[model samples]
Structures are given as C-alpha cells and as structure tokens.
Target chain A: MEITPEKLRWIYTTMYRIRRFEEVLLEQTALGKSMGVAHTSDGEEAGPTGICAHLTDDDWIASTHRGHGHCIAKGVDTAGMMAEIFGKHTGLCKGKGGSMHIADFTKGMLGANGIVGAGIPLGVGAALSAKLKGDGSVGVSFFGDGATGEGTIHESMNLASVWKLPAIFVCENNHYAESTPVEYAVSVADIADRAASYSMPGVVVDGMDVFAVYDAAGEAIARARAGEGPTFLELKTYRYHGHFHADDPHTYRLPEEEELWKARDPLPNFERRVTEQDLMDDVEMERIRNEIDQEIQDAVKFAEESPLPPLEELYTDVYVNYSNPPQGLR
Target chain B: MTLDLRPDPLGPGFDVPGSEIRYREAFNRTLGDELRRDPDVFVMGEDVAGGAGREHLGIIDSWGGAFAATKGLIQEFGAERVRDTPISEAGFVGAAIGAALTGTRPVVDLMYFDFITVAWDQLLSNAAKNRYMFGGQGKIPITLFARSGVAAGYSAQHSQNFYSMVAHIPGLKCVAPSDAYTCRGLLAAAIRDDDPVIVCNHKKLINMSSFVPDESYTIELGKGRYLRRGSDVTLVGMSYTTEVCRLAAERLAEQGINAEVVDMLSLSPIDEDIVLESVTKTNRIVIVDEDTPRCNMASDIAALVADKAFDSLDAPVKRVTGPHTPVPYSKPLEDAFIPSPEDVVATTVALLGA
Candidate 1:
C-alpha cells in the first residue's frame, strides 16, 4: 500500500483539476453562460481521483449528477464536457444532454444520471457483462450519500453479490442530499455496513485523503477482478459549494460545520502531505496549479466560441438510424 | 399479399396449421434457437430457471417463468446464459440495458407488462435513451418480453394493456403480436435489432396458436399485415383484437358488406402507407383496440387518417375501444370492458352507414 511518487503527482494533479473545473463552472453560471443547473465536486475530488487512478479504460464507471470530476478522472475530454455544459454542438452529447446527463461511452464512463441511485444497477449490469465476457475488467458506481436511501442500490448490491459479479460500489457521503441533511435521511450509521447483508466486503475511509481511498479502492477492485465478488466502500467527504449552482447551502448548513469541513479541504490536505514528505515541492505544486488553471481557461474559451447545436441535431442522436421512424420523432 | 380467409385453427387445446404450437411454445423455441445461434445472447428474469442457485429436487427448471415463456431454456443455455433473478425489476432491467451496452444481447422478461411500472425508469430513461443520449456511441439491443391484456381472471392489477405508454416514448420500439406466426418473427427481429424493443404478448392469446415456422426467421419491424382484404371498409386491429376483427369481418360478409382487416403489428412506427392505402381503397375505416381509449393507438391511428387520408375518407374514423377503467374481475363486467367481435361488427356497420 506504499504510495509512489507518480501516484502522488497524479492524485495531486487530478484533485486540483477537479477543483479548478468546478471553479470555472461556478464562474460560467454566475455569468449566465451555462445552460442548466450544475452540481460541482469542489471538495470531493479525492474520492474520484483515488478510485479512478486504479482503473483503466477497459473498466467502466457509472456516475451521478455531480459528475464532472468522475468524468475527468475516467479520461473523458474536458473540452467536450465544457462544450456540453455550454450547450454547444461540439458537446459530448451534441448539446442534447447538458451537465446532468453528460456521458462518453468510449472512455467507459456511463452517462451521469439525473436520477439518484439509478447508476448502481447500471454499474452492476456492466460488471455482469464483463463477467460473462470472462474479462478481468470491473465496473464501479460513484453515488452520493443521498443515493444510499434508494432501493436500486440495495437491489443492485444483492444481485451483484449473488451472481458474484465484479462490481464496486463507492458511496461519497458528503453529509447532504440536496438541502436535506444526511443525518435525518439515512437510517444507517455507516452506509458501508449494509454491504454485510449482501455478503460483501465493506470499508469506510477518509474521502479527503487520496492515499487512504487509493489503497482501499485498489484492494476492493483487485478482489472484484479475482472473482471474489462486489465490495462497498463509503468515503466520508463534503461538498464545498451548495447542492447546485443556484442553491443556497446556508439555508440548511450550519456555519460551524462548514468551517470545520473547510479546514480539512481535500485539495489542501493532499498538497500538505505531498509537500511535507518532499514527494513534491511548493514550486512543483504551483506549476501544476497554474497548468490546470490555464487548461480550464482554454476549455471555457473553446466552449464560448463553439456554435450552438443545429435544430436538426434534435433528431440526430436519438438512435443509430437517424432515419428509422420507430425511434425517431418523424 | 393475398388475405388468408381460412378460419383460425386455434381451438380445443390451441391447435394450428402444419404442427399446432401454442403461443408460449413458439416463444420458447425462439429463445432456444437464438441462444444456440449467438454466443453473446442470454435470457434472465424472475423464475426464468426457477432453480438458478439451488437444485430443484432433481428438477432443473420448475417455473419456466410466469407464463412458461422461458420454459426449458435453462437446460439448453445453462445457468449463466439463462439466469433466474430475485423480484427486483429495476435492478435486472437496468442490468440488461448495461449488458446490451457492453456486448451481450439480452432478452429480459419483465414477467408481467403491469410490473414494468416498477422498472419504468430503467426502460424509459436508460434503455431507451442510451443510444441517443450517448451521441450514437452506445446501443441497447435488449428485447423486453411482457404479457399484456387480460387473462381469464388475472383481474385489474395483472391485466392492463399499457403498450401505448411505452409507444409514446421516442427511442423505444413496441410490438404486440396477434398470433404465434407473428410472435416468433417479431421477437427474433427484436433480439437481433440494434435498438431496444418491447414485445407485448397478450396473456389471453398465450394458449392460441397459428402457423409459425419451426426455424428462426425475423419479420420486419414497423410493418403492418393485411389479415383480410376487401373494398367496402378497412377494419384496424392490434394484438388480440386482430382475431376479433377477423371474426367481425366474417359476420360482415354474411351481411353482404366487405371489410378489409388490417393488423397494426408494430404500434409505434406504424405502417402508415399500408393504412393510408387501405383507407383510400375502402373509403371507410374502423379502429379496434383493447387498450383504454384516450392516448392509445386508436387515437394515434385516427389522427394519422385525419391528417393524411382525409380526402380519401368517405366517412369519419370510428373506434371501438376498451373502457377507461381498469379490467374488472367480474366476468360480466370484464366482458363489457373489453371490446368484442360484436362491437367491431357494430362499429364497422356504423362507419358504413355514416
């Protein structure tokens, strides 16, 4: 479980990249350049950065509405994603699916679902496909603490365990489900504990620490690849922003809790660990930060300059046969 | 194509031409043939094997599914290819979509079409939307099998026809086979096609059989069949209602009125040219559907005729449909709720009079 210098650099860059990407989205929303509402992964970067670091393009991951970080970590082009958010023709879904439904099948990143807990069963399905194909590839599901309340998660977990499918369920417990506090919504003390009912391994980790999540996710993924069945990992983390761009977190969040979480911000925590151990110096960290910032700026520019999708595009991607009437509007 | 005016041979044990095969048997044979033909094809549903994980006291497949639609598939394909699942529709249905997205072409049984409501999100949102939502990078080649319409006494909950609800969705293809011959071909086409298709087999017609080929062959989707042809008036029917239309046509012949019966096989991408041509030739039309009247195929077909065949129509389109309420348990009430051959005859007569 020893962390390599290369892994540290990747985790640092990924976490910062997620932070910067969300910041640009926030700016776009403020300027009214974005299409619909968006949920950002400002402080929850470590979870995706750690878990996806162990995955290859052969593996698959299903994500939630707040899924930009997962898309980036899974290798979905940021330029295409930003263009989608801006409702341009060059978007991943050709502007048909905005932020909430962004997807890139080539990268094995299933579409981000608008419905909570919907991705769990889809991930289990991909795992079933991989198992049937006799490949060692696995499928991962990234969902929020709120999704733990959905029946789909429980059904998917039991099915995966019974079939011994290679599926990993990662619960990002960000302490909130939209405006509702997780404490009032979830009946379980630890969401991972539910895994035992399905006869699967369950682990809890510090979502703010990239190293901890990396080690835990790696073990679970390895177990899945070896045909040991599914694993549930509950990562405790927090979202620095409101539930969505237009939402007011202060209405439901207490000032003291927000302050306590900010002190343990995932980006700053990873930067401190890397710098303190001399795995990476301040100069190197600054360079990575500047590079990500410039990248985000370029993506915004690309999205802004891109043309609006043509009206005929409305009927284009609905099916492979753009002319077949069964799946077409015409 | 000449209309086969021969009386339905399905009776007193569900007989048919050549070798009499029941609707369920045709379905079973098709699954076995497809599994043997393709390596990536599989069948999964509740009670599909009935003995998936545990031994069934020397019996391999006990239930064979709710309607015996998947009987004997477990023995042929084994447990991995023919899997029995818990009563979790959303999970398995979504999983089927996932499997189709990756490599497998899965045929999933939703058990009862009524139960699709539980897994509606998966079918409507994911399965139907994936191909288009992913910018043509993904395709869901999954065939969903479900029994719609009333069986003798299954009552309101288990006996509703909701294929119209699925037909309204953009990326979904819906088919309701009237008999055994159409069922095998349509089901095979649904499995081999690169899009998600829902095959709604009427529960009442499961025992009835027609002349179906013993081998695998696919009938083209989105094509309507002219069950019987005449020039006096066009009678439109779908699913089990097609039988009623044929019987009504015979009764009309006794009255010296010719009725051309059209079976609306593929509901969504309806064969508009056939329908328009039939109406244009006959100059009179009557639509018979077992589903509740509003927002159903009857209304959709009516709109199509009104829009495209308005000049050819000598009379306004007439429709005989089921009542808006759920299928009743009482025999008399249920009989009244469903449209009968007599209703079709009366509707066609009224259209001619108008």
Candidate 2:
C-alpha cells in the first residue's frame, strides 16, 4: 500500500489522539471527575486507526468495552465523549451512556457495548441493512479475543457469510478477558482461523504495526466493498492497562509480557517509520503532540464546566409515548 | 388514574363488521398490510418465509412459520421483504435490533414465547435499553411476535406464557390481544409504535374467529376494553385469559352474578386506570392470568389493587392463576396446570359472597 503524506499524518494523529484520550481520561477519573468504570484502549490503537482510516461516516462500526480508540478513529467528538464519561448534560449521550457505551450514530459509531459479544450481530445487522438499501456501506465489529468464545460471534459470522453481507469482524487479541488468559479460553490457536468454519477469508495481522494492519485491512475491506463477503482479521494486540480502570494488570500479566508488548507501542513505531522515511520531521511530530495535549486539557475543562442532566431525565426516552399512569415523579 | 378508555377501541367502524377471521389470519394480514404500508418494514425469523433462497428448487415459503401466522406472505412480498433466517435466535434477534437501531422497521417472529430466553439478553440489554441508554437519540421500532402458552403437549421447553418477565422491564412494551379483532389492531399498533414492542400471540386463540374490519387503524396502546359489562363484580384477564374471563362471565350470569369482563390488552403500559376503575366500581375483582401464580401478571395487578384501591374493595383481590410449576407434558397434568374458567368463576363467586 502506498503511503500518502496526508494518510500518514492522519494515522499518527488518530492513534496519538486515542493514546492521549485514554491517558487523560484516567487522570480525570482519578481526580473524581468521571462517573463509572472506563476500559482503556491504550495499546490497541493501530487496529481501529488503521482500519477506520479506510472508512467514512457512511460505514458503521460496533465497538466493545475497550472502545475509546474506535470512537476517536471513527471521528466521534472527543470533547463530547469526555463530558459523557463525566456524566454531564453536554455529554455525547446526554450524560447517560458514560464510558462503556459512548455512541454517535451520525458518525457510524454504533456504540461501545457493555456486554461481551452483544455488539457483533449489530454490525451484521448494519451490513444487512446496507445490502437491502444498496447503499454500498459496510459494518465492522471490534471485540476482544475473549469474545470469540461467545456464541454471538460465531452466529454473526455465519449469518454474514451466508447472506454474503459486507461486514468485518476484527478481534483484538489483547491476551486477557478480565483475569482469564486468551490461550486458556479460546479453542483455536488463531482466532482468525475460526472464520474458515464460516467460509470467510481469515487473516492474521500484527496489531502493533499500523502499516501492516492498514495493508491487510485494505484488502479485506476491498473484498467486502466488492460484495464478495465478510472477512475476519485477528490483530494480535495488547492493552497496557487492566480490563477496567480499577483493575491491576500486574495481578494477571507478567512484568516481561507487559514490557515486551509495550516495546512495540504503535505511536513510537509510527514516529520512527515516518521520520526515517523522511515523510515527516521531528518539529511536525512535536506540533501534533502539543496540539493533542492541549486538546485533552480543553476536553477536561469542558466536562468540568458542563452541568449534570436535569432530574426529570429519569422519565424520558423509555418509549415514544406511554400514557398510562403518565411519566414523571410522584 | 381512571378507566378513561377513549371511546371504544373497536371504534364506530364496528357499525359495519367487515368479515369473520381467525387470529392467525388477522396476524398474517396485518403483517402483509404493515409491510406494504411502509417500505422500510421487513420481517426475519426462523422459517418466517420458509425455504426461501430455494427458488431454484421451487420451494418458497414451504412452512410459512410454525403456526402458519405468516402463511402465504412470501408469495406476495417476495423473499427479500419477508426473509427467513438460520435457527440462531439470539443472533437474528440482535441483528433485528441492530437494523432497527440504524434505520428500518424490523418485525421478528420469535417462533415460541419459551424461546424468548435464548434472545432475552439482546432484548433486555440492547433492544429494550438502547433508546434510553443512548440518551434518547434513537428509536428501536422493532416488533417481535410469538405464540405464547402451553398447549397441545408442547411440554415445558416449547410452551410458556412469560410476558410477565418482559413486562418487568421498563423499556420493552408487551401486548396480549384476546380476540381476532384486537389481535389485528394491536399488532398494527405495535408495528407502528416507535419502540421495542412484543406482540404476545396466545396458542389457544390462534384458531378462534371474530369480526375484523378491513381498514387499517391502530388501537391506543396500553389501553384495555370491556367485553362484558355488569355491576356485581369485575373479572379481569389478558390474551386467552380474557376469553376465559368472557366464559366465566357467562357462567356467573347463569347464577345471576352480574360479572363485568375487562380484557387487559397491553400488559407493559397496562391500563392501570382500567384495572383500578373496574375494581372501584365493582368493589370486588378476580384477576385471571394463565402465567404462574408467583410474581406474575396476576400478582402485579393484585398488588396494584391492594395499594391503590384498598378502601374500595368489598373483599381481598382474588387471583385465579396457574400453579407455580413447569407446564407439564402429561395431558391431565397440563390441563390441571392451566388456570381454567371454572377457577375464575369460583374465585369471583367466592370473593363476591365474602
């Protein structure tokens, strides 16, 4: 794949933005700003940034608990996302969804589901919708390696393949689902290999390398766009932190494993590749970093200034209209 | 709240009765009408269009769904609009929810009410909660229908009247229509409603016939109607239980006990006003529910009466409900498990005398 100057800049910017958002959101959480648990997507930035770079708002992507990276890559408003985690009135979901369920349908970010494998079939549904309308749009689902064991993943893949729907199932092999290691829970050696059972093309990509993901995902996405069928990509990745903000990765992960995965961090690797190839200079990289730093600060400030949603929000949106014993507090 | 039902839901259209149709035909016709009414509306479920994608072999809609509720639909709508899916309940239901979320009105035939457990997580977590949790930006205009209740020796796994579980959830709406009339009308209302609505199709009522209008109209959701009127005592029921209530009212009438029959249609945004009003007027009520006794619809209504209409009660609110047990397979055992009209009449008579 040819790397244009603009495309290279977008990958760096999007990936770095995700890293900073996860980092700053945690700092804010520690300061008693956020409402609930937040799962960081610090190390798995390449998977979403590389693939979503190929997408427009016309395409849809369903996300999992570790979904901040997918949200940023899909171009969901960062400030609105920050307020959502803060549970403020100006939040993305009007202060209701919080971290694990940030969504913007206009941007084709379906939602960051709280359930393990609940979002997979949703992506297939989107693809089915696109196929019916002849819209030429595709749906992508991002989930952890653990979600492969879930029946929804298998069922979704089978449906997508059977219908020949334009869908992609990207599994982020982050090695752990909560405390359980992937190897112990998963049935196959490679999660992508399971796609063979569904008669879809399965590819293994180095998730730590954004360029490799870009190339593999480009081919897979092209096949889907051509209406060949769905594809499964197992991006072997890792999360720097634990399953959730309050969890300690050190409890389950070894020091060597953590350090080993962190050594190939996508951000620094991208910086090296770009500068070595003379595509971008140190000054340009520094400028991007500084802007992202300021942006994260502005997000925190916006969340702090935003108010909580009014009390009456408790009664709204359950149904379009349910008049019996009319809604509201007694 | 009062039983302020807006006129008659059957409406002045009842002045000219269209035709007598079975419950299954009403459901099938309503589905066809709704699909034609909206271009975005589509149906998907196991064998909903049956043997679709086998047109090369010329075996389209060979099944037309388990109960034939969707009979002869694929021929009119084509396989594209009336789709058949693999036997993955959770997968397709979630997909239906997702399609509903993005854009498009999806009607899912859940096959049987007992199988609701397989797709419960999706309905509970995604379809039901999406609008509220996502800050009310979207609407899940997904309609799900299924045959409910134990009948014809379906045993425990295949037979269930578990609308009570759905009623417990805040976001999902549930409706149980007693006769062919409400079956067609309430179904149209559910398909049009901008929410996740489950239309409970009772097994026994599927073959029962009643007068249905040819016109398309939506009955007010969350509203109940009176099938019989009297001043002595109120007999309340839903779905097939409403038919049971009608029968019990006739039996009570023979004994000179004027029994008013209240058919509680929609269960979620239940006509609390109607339930309260009926009990208030009669000062005595017997709630008949085919679901098990514990924490079921009967208990829920009984609680509502106990809390709100405590002073108006001539006697304690009586609930003639199925025993708390799995619907057995044995003919006699299954018969005993179901709450009969005799039970309702006896409960109402005992309460009236008290």
Candidate 3:
C-alpha cells in the first residue's frame, strides 16, 4: 500500500496527539485536578495510530485499559475524553466511566475495558454484526501481550475463525502487564504464534515504526473485509510510564531496559523517518507538533472547566426504563 | 383447577392441544417464532446448534443445549442464525452483549445457572453496566437464558437458584416463570425489552405443561399475577416454589383454611403493590423460595413486608426456603434440600396458630 502525503501527515499528527494527551493527563493528575488513576500509552503510539488509520466510523475498535491512544486514533473527541477523566457531567460517559472506561460509540470506538482480554469477544460480536448486516465493516480488538494469556482471547479468536467473521486481533505487546513481565506470564515466545492454533495468520510488526504497522494492518484489515476471517497482528510495543499513575516500575523492571526502549521512541523515530524520506519537512512537523500540543491543552482546559455530575444522576442511567425502583435500592 | 385466562389455545389445530406442550417446547416455539418474526434475532450457545461441521459423522445438533430448550432451533433458523459456540461462556456472552449494543437482539444460553461464575464479569461488569457506564448511549437488548432449581439429582454444582445474585445488580432484570405459560410470555417479553433480562427456567418445571397460547404474547415484567385468591392468608411463591405453594394452598383448602397463592414471577422489580395489597387483606404472609435461606428473595420479600406492611400483619411473617446447604445429588437428599409443599403448608398453619 502506497502512503499518500495526507495519510502520512495524519499518521504523524495522531501519534503526536496521543503522546501530548497523556502528558497533559499526567500533569492534571499531578496538580490534583483529576482524582482517578490512568494508564498511559506513552511509548506505544504507532500501533493504534497506524491500525486505526485503515478504519472508518462504520468499522469498530475495542480497546484496553491503556486506551487513550486508540480512542484518539479512532477519532474519539479529545475534549469529551478529558472531561470523562475529570468525572464531569459533559464527559463521554456523562461522568460515569472515568479514564479507564472512555468511549465514543459515535466513532465506533468501544469503551476502554478494565478487565484484561475482555474486548476481544466484544470485537468478535461486532464482527458478527457486520457480517450479518453485510456492511463490509471489520472490527478490531486492541489488547496487550499480557492479555494473550487470558482464555477469552483464545476463545474469541477461535470463534472468529470458526465463524469466518470480519475481525482483526491487534496485540499491543507492551512487554509487561502491571509488574509482571510477559517473559514470565506468557507461555509462547511470540504472542502471534499462538494464533496458529486457531488457524489464522499471525504476523509480527515493528510497533515503533508507523509505516510497518500501517502496511501490516492494511493487509489484515483488507483480508477481514473480504470475509477471509481474522488475523492476529502482534505489535511489539512498550510503555514508558508505570502501569497506573501510582505504580513504580523501578521496583520490577530494570532502568537500563527502559532507557533502551526510550531510545526507539515512536514519535521521534517517525519524525526522522518521514523527514528523511521527504514525506514531510521539519517545518511542517514542528507545526503539527505545536498544533497537537495546543489541542491537548484545550482538552485539559475543557475538563477543568466542566462541572461534576449531580448526585441525582446516579439512578438515571442504570436501566433504560427503570420505573419501579426495586424496594431494596429505593 | 388451573387458571385458563385466555381462549382455549387449540380448537382448530390439527394434532394436539396447545396445553399439551412442555415448557421446553414453549421456549423452542418462542425462539422459532421470533426468528421468523424478526430478522435481527438469533440464538447462540454451547451445543445450541449441536453438531457443527460434523455432518458426515451424522452428529447434527446432538445435545440441543444442556436442557433441550434450543432443540431443533437450528433446523428452523439455519446455522447462521442458530449458532453453536465452544465451551466459552465469557467470550460468547460478551459477544452477545456487543451484538445487542450494535443491532442484533441475541438470546444467549448459559446452559446452567451454576456456570455463571465463569462468565460473571462479562454479564455483571459489561452487559449490566454497558448502557449506564456509557451514559445510556446504547441498548443491550440481550436475553441470558439459564436453568435453575433443585431436583433432578444434578448435584450441588449444577443445581442452585442463583438468579438472586444477578437480580441484586442495578441494571439487570430477572424473570422466573412458574409454568409453560409464564415461561413463554415472560421469555418473549425479556427478549423484546431494551435492557438485559435473565430468564431463569426451573429445570424441574421445564417438563411441566400449561394452557399456552399458540401465538406469542408478553407478560409485563414487574406485575405479579395471582394464581388463586382467598381471605385467610397470602402465600408468596417464586418460580418453581409457586407449584409447591399452590399444592399447599389446595391442602389448606381441604382443611377449611382459605389460602391465597401469588406467584412472584418477576423477582427484581417485584410487584410490591400486589404484595402489599394482599398483605393488607390477609394480614398474614408466607414467602417461599428455592434459594438458600439467607440473602435471597425470601428475605427481601420478608423485609419489604416488615418495613412497609408491619401495621397490617396479624402475626410475624414466615419464610419457607431450601436449607442453607448445597443441593445434594441423592434423590432423598435433594428432596429434603428443596422446600416441599408440606413445608409451606406447615409454615402457614404454624403462623396462623401463633
């Protein structure tokens, strides 16, 4: 697949937006504005940015705990997401779902799940809907290396394959699940290799390189849309921050490994590669970076200004038609 | 002495009367009718389709589901609509939620209520919370069909009435049908509702027959129905226990005690007005349940009467429930575990004497 200049710029801009969004989120949490925990997708940007570039709003994507990048890449409104993190009334989930559960159904971006590997089966269901509707839309599930060990992932993949549903299983292998490293938790060396058991194609991509993911995901998505069943694409990525805002990675992983991974940071690497390839110049890149930084700032300001949801809002959405309050709750 | 509220179900049909069908047949007919009526509805679960990709082995839809509730659905709807999945509860249930959120209305079979533990998160955390957590942006019109109740000698693992667990959650609705009639109507209502509803079919009651309409109809979810009415006392029975309560009421009638039987069909958003109204008249209530003694629907009903209808009560409310032990496998032990009709009659007589 040939990369057009417009697509290249979009790719660069989305990656930058994801990075700045997380940075602004960290700053807000540090300043005591937002109260809940957040899992940052710092070093892992290209995976979501590249894969989601191939999708439209008619298609769907299910995300994980570290899912802001996926939401941004799939076109979830940043201001609404920031407001959700703030637990405000104007948030994406109307202040009910916080950072870990940010979602935008309008963009076909399913909510960020708190449970590991939970999104896989949801994506399979979306794929089933797409197939039954004959909409030519494919579903993508973005999980982590840690989730490959979850039985739901295996079950989802097998179901998708057996049914020949239009689905893509994207494994964002960030090397560690909380404090436990994938080297210890996962039985297989390559998470993609496990896909062979389900009779689906397994491919590994350089997660830090946007073009590599863009090419691999394009093929996988096309195959899915063509009714060729599911593909397991393992994107070898990393997280620069701790599991959550409060976790300490130094207690588990070596500092040297973090340093090594940081040297291959996706944002800077993509900038150099694009500029060297004459896809875009340093001037345009700088302008894009500044624009995204401003967007992140605007989101933070919007979240800060939004009001918290009132106490009465709690009982409203629990059921679509909750007329008779069960005696216990009433 | 059963109630036939509607027209005799089968006057012109060729073969058997509508009242001759089992609860499972009512369930299967409902599924077939829905599949024919709406294009967006489908059925899925382990062994739902029975035999998939094994036509040469001559094993086509062998199990038909754990209790035969989905038997012969695949032949009517085809494999596309009636899907058989692997033994993965969380995966398929989560998928069902996703499908419901999108466009299709999926009826997922949990096989047995006991296995809900494996897929608890998918139903509780996702299916129950999807609409609320997402600010009501989507509708999870999903029906989770499972079998419950004590008897059949299925042992502790497979025989427990755990509908109360899901009923306790805020976003879910629980419906337990007493006979084939309620099962058909309530199951249809649950499928059509734009919220997640669990239809807990009593394994012992699935074979029981009732005068059911050949055409599909829905019972309003939270409205309790009275099987029999009298002046002496009110017997509140739930799901399978309703049968026992009715039997007990019959024996009470022989003893000159005019006992009323009220089937607490919808357990969650319980028909409090009906319960309170009955309590006001009779001034004595006995709640019967198949679940364990503590923290179950029996306790909930008892508390509701105590808090709201205390002044009307002539004596302390009585509760007849299964012992606080796992259902045993042996027939005698299982019989002892479940609340018997004699137990309900004994409790009501004792309450009147007190």
- Per-residue alpha-carbon lDDT of candidate 1 for residues B261-285, written as tens digits (9 for 90 to 100): 9887888666787788899999999
Tens digit per residue, CA lDDT, model 3, A176-273? 98989999998888889988999999999999888899999999999999989999999998998899977879999999999998999998898888
Task: Rank candidates, DockQ, best first.
Answer: 2, 3, 1
Quality class of the docking in candidate 1, CAPRI style: medium
Superposed by TM-score, candidate 2 places the C-alpha of residue B106 at a distance from the truth, in angstroms, of: 0.6
Docking class of 3: medium
TM-score of each: 0.96, 0.98, 0.96
Candidate 2: tens digits of C-alpha lDDT, residues B135-161: 887788999999998789998988789
Residue lDDT tens for model 1, A38-77 = 9998989889999999999989999999999999889888
Candidate topping lDDT: 2
Q: Judged by TM-score, which candidate is best? A: 2
* Tens digit of per-residue lDDT, candidate 2, span A231-326: 999999999988898898888889999899999999899999988889999999889999999998999999999999997787777777786533
Task: Output the better candidate (1/2) by lDDT.
Answer: 2
How many clashes show up in model 3? 2
Question: Where does model 1 exceed 4 Å of error?
Answer: A322-330, B1-18
Interface Cα RMSD in Å, per prediction: 1.7, 1.0, 1.1
